[model samples]
Target: MKRLLVTGSNGLLGQKITDLLVQGQFPNFEYIASSRGADRFDAKAYHYLDLDITHHAQVLKAIETYSPDIIINTAAMANVDACEREPAKSYEVNVAAVANLIKICEDRNIHLIHLSTDFVFDGEEGPYEEDDRPNPVNIYGEHKMAAENLLQQAACPWSIVRTILVYGVLRDLSRSNIVLWAKNALENGQPIRVVNDQWRMPTLAEDLAKACLVVAERNATGIYHISGKDMFSICEIVEAVIEHYRLDASFICKEASEALNQDAKRPKRTGFILDKAYEKLDYVPHSFGEGLKLIDEQLAKLQSS
Candidate 1:
C-alpha cells in the first residue's frame, strides 16, 4: 500500500480528509494523520503525533520516521489578523516550515502536496488564473506567497492547491469561518456586519479535501486554483447562510468597509479561474448554491444532534 503523510491532520481540511479516508472515500492508501494534538482513533492505521513544523529537526524527523511516498502539508498559521500582528511567527510556520518539508521531500523523492490561499493575490482584478502574478496586501498573503515561491524553487515534484474562504468544521466554534459566524449570529438573534465590497470563491472543506486527494493521486505538479464555481461578497454569503438556516434575513447587515475591524488590508476580490483544475485534474468544483445547500444540511444535522 502506498503510504501518505497528512500534516495538519487535526485541522478543518485535514480532519475532513481523514474522515473521508477513514470512511473508505479514498482506497488503496495507508494514511498517517499527524497534528499538534489529537490522541484517540479507532484503529492502528491512525498515528497521531505532536509535530511543530517550525522546528526543522522535528519536521525532518517526522518525515524520516513516516517515510511517506506522498506528503500533504496543511499546517499553517492562517489567522489573517494574527498573521499581521505576528509576521515573524507566521513566516516561521507558513514559509520556513514549508521550505524544510520541501527539502525532506526532495531528498526522499516524495511527492509534496502543499495547500495555499487565495489571499496570495492582492485581489486587484481578481478571478485570478494559475499564471497570474501574485501581489499580496497583507503578511498572511506574503507568507503564503513566499512558501509558494519556495516550493516552486524546490527540486522535487510538488503540487500547490490554492483555495479561497474555506468553510467547515475546526474553524472556531464561535466565530472562526464566515458561514459559521453568520449561522451562530442568526441563531443567537444577533446582527452581523459583513463586507460587501470584497469578493471571493468560497470553497467547502470537504470539496477541498477531495480535491487534494485527486491532485495527490494524479501527481499533478505546479499550481492549481481549486475554488467554488461562483463569486460572492461576504455579505452575500452571510445572506445565503441566513436564508439556508431559515433565519431572519435582516440579521446580516452589509458593511461598506472591513477596514475598521481588519488589522491588515484585504483585497477587494481574490477568487480564481479553475479551468486548469478541470482540464488537468478532472475537478468539478461545486457551485456556491450547491455548496450552501450542503453546508445547510450539515448545520441542520449538527443542530439536531
Candidate 2:
C-alpha cells in the first residue's frame, strides 16, 4: 500500500481525512497523520507524528521519516481576523510553510495536495470558475493566494483544492464550525447576529476530504473548486440550521457584513463553481441540509460516546 501523509492531523479537515482513511474502508493507501503536537484522537489504527510544518527542519524531518508517496497539507492559519492581527505569523504558517512542503515534495517527487480557500477572490463576483482571477481583500486571503502561487511554481505534481465555509465535528477537537455554532446558540436561546450579504457554498468537511482523496487517487494536477452544491447567504445558513434542529428562528439577527465590525474584510458573495472538479475528479458535494443531518448524526455519536 502507498503511504499518504497528512499534515494538521488535529484540525477539522485533517481529522475528517483521517476518519475517512481509517474508518471509510479505503484500503489502497496507508496514512501517517501529523500535527503540531501529540495525537489528539483516540484512534490507534494509523501512525501519528509530531510535526510543526512552520519549521522547515521539522517539515523536512517528517517527510524524510515518513517517505510518503503523497502529502495532503490541510494545515493553515485559517482565522481571518487572527491572520490580520499577526500578518507575519500568518505568512509563516500559510505561505512559508507551504513553500517548504512544496520544495520537499518536489525534491522527493511526491504528489502534494494543498488546501486553499475561496477568500482568494475579492467577493465582488462569485461562484468562481477555475480560471477566474484572484484579487484577495484581506491578509488571510493574501497569504493563501501567495501559497497558491508557490504551488503553481512547484516542479512536482500538485493539486490545490479550494473550499469554503467548511463545517463538521471531531471527537476531541474544541474547534467550532458554523453548523455547530448556530445549533448551540439557537438551542440555548441565545440571540446571534449573522451576515445576510455574504454568500458561500458551506462545504461539508467529509465532502472536502473525499475531494482530496479523489485528487490523490487520480494524481490530478491544477486548481479545483471543491465545495457544497447549495449556495446561500450566511444568514440563510443559520436559518437553515435553526430549521433543521427545530430551534426558534426569532433569536437570529440578520445583519449586513459591514455592520459586523469585524477586523478582517469579508467577501460579499464568493462561492465556488465546481465544474472543473466534477469533470476532472468526478467530485460531488453534499447539500447544506444533508450536511446538517450528517452533523447531527456525528454530534449524536459524539454525545453517546
Candidate 3:
C-alpha cells in the first residue's frame, strides 16, 4: 500500500491502528490519521489531519488532496438510542457520509475499508454468516446496513468489517465501554442493572484494528465478521469483568433487556460466524479472558502513566 488513511483517528480502534503502524507493522506504508476535531492521538510518527467525514465538500477536498491508497472509515454515529432520537442527524453521519466516501473512492480508485456492527442482523438467527441477509431491527442497525448496501453497489474496491461490543482503554480516555463501566461500578459497589437477555461476542479494539489492517494488506473484499471467539450475555460479560478484576459482583443486578427501557430496541442475539474472517484474513481474535487480561495490564499502565 502506498498510503493508508484512517478516519476517526482518535477512536479506540483508530488509535490502536496508529499504535500498530508506529510499532512497525507495515512500516513502509505512509499513514494519515484524521478526525473531526484536533488530533487526540499522542503519536507523531504519522501525519494527522482534521477531517469531518460528514461534511461533503471538506471530505471531497481531503480525498483529492491526500489521494490515499486506502481509506479506513471508522467514524459513525454508533449510539443506538441517539440514532433513534435523531435519525436525520444519524443518517448524515452513518449513511450519507459513507455515500460520499464511496463516490470519492470510486472516482479515485482508493480502497475503502468501512467498520460496521453485527447489528445489521435482526438477531432472529445468529451467529450470522458472511452472506446472511440483513434485517436490521433498529435505526442504528438500519443505517449501518444501508451503508453496507452502498458499499456493495460501489465500483471501488471495498471491504466491510462487522464487529460487536468493542472495548478497550485509550491514552486520552475519550469514552468508556462496557468492560470499564462494569469494572468501575463494581469497584464502587454501585448497583448497576445489566441486561441478561442480549448476547454478543464482544470484540477487543486492538483485535478489530488488526483485522482491519489484515483485510487491507491481503486485499480482501466483501463482508468479514470479526469479533471475540466466545459469546455471552451482557450480564455474563460483566460478571467476567468482575471476576477478572476480583471486584464485588454483588453490585450487579441481572435484569432482562425490557427492564432497561432503552430508547433503541436492541437485538436479542447477534453474533458473527467468523470462519470467513479466519480463512480469508488469517484473523484470530483473543478469547474474552485473554482480551480482559490485556486490558487489565493496560489499565495498570495507564494508572502509572
**RMSD of every prediction:** 2.1, 1.1, 0.9
Ranking by lDDT: 3, 2, 1
| Residue 171 error, candidate 2, Å | 1.9
The CA lDDT at 134 in model 3 is 90
What are the lDDT scores of the predictions, listed in order?
A: 0.84, 0.90, 0.90
Tell me the deviation in Å of residue 135 in model 3: 0.6
lDDT against true structure, model 3: 0.90
Model 2 pairs in collision: none
Error in Å for residue 275 of model 2: 1.3
lDDT of 1 by residue, 1-305 (tens): 77888888767888778878888877867888887755333345566677777878987888888889998899888899999999999988999889889989889899999999988898889999988999999999999999999999888989999999998754223226887777777899997777889998899888899999988788889999998888988878887777777899876677777545778889889889989988998888777777777766776676777
Per-candidate clashes, comma-separated: 0, 0, 0
Better of 1 and 2 by lDDT: 2
Between prediction 1 and prediction 3, which has the larger TM-score? 3
Question: After TM-score superposition, what is the CA distance of residue 94 in candidate 1 from its true location, in Å?
Answer: 0.4
Q: Residues 1-305, candidate 2, lDDT per residue (tens digit)?
A: 88899999899999888888988556788889998888876499999998899989988988898899999999989999999999999999999999989999999999999999999999999989987999999999999999999999999999999999899888874679898888888889999999898989898999999889888888898999999998898888888888888999999898888898998999889998888888898887888888888888888898898
**Cα deviation of 74, candidate 2, in Å:** 0.4
The segments of candidate 1 whose C-alpha lies over 4 angstroms from its true place after superposition are 39-45, 170-175, 303-305
Give the poorly placed runs of model 3, Cα more than 4 Å off. none
Q: Work out the TM-score per prediction.
A: 0.94, 0.97, 0.98
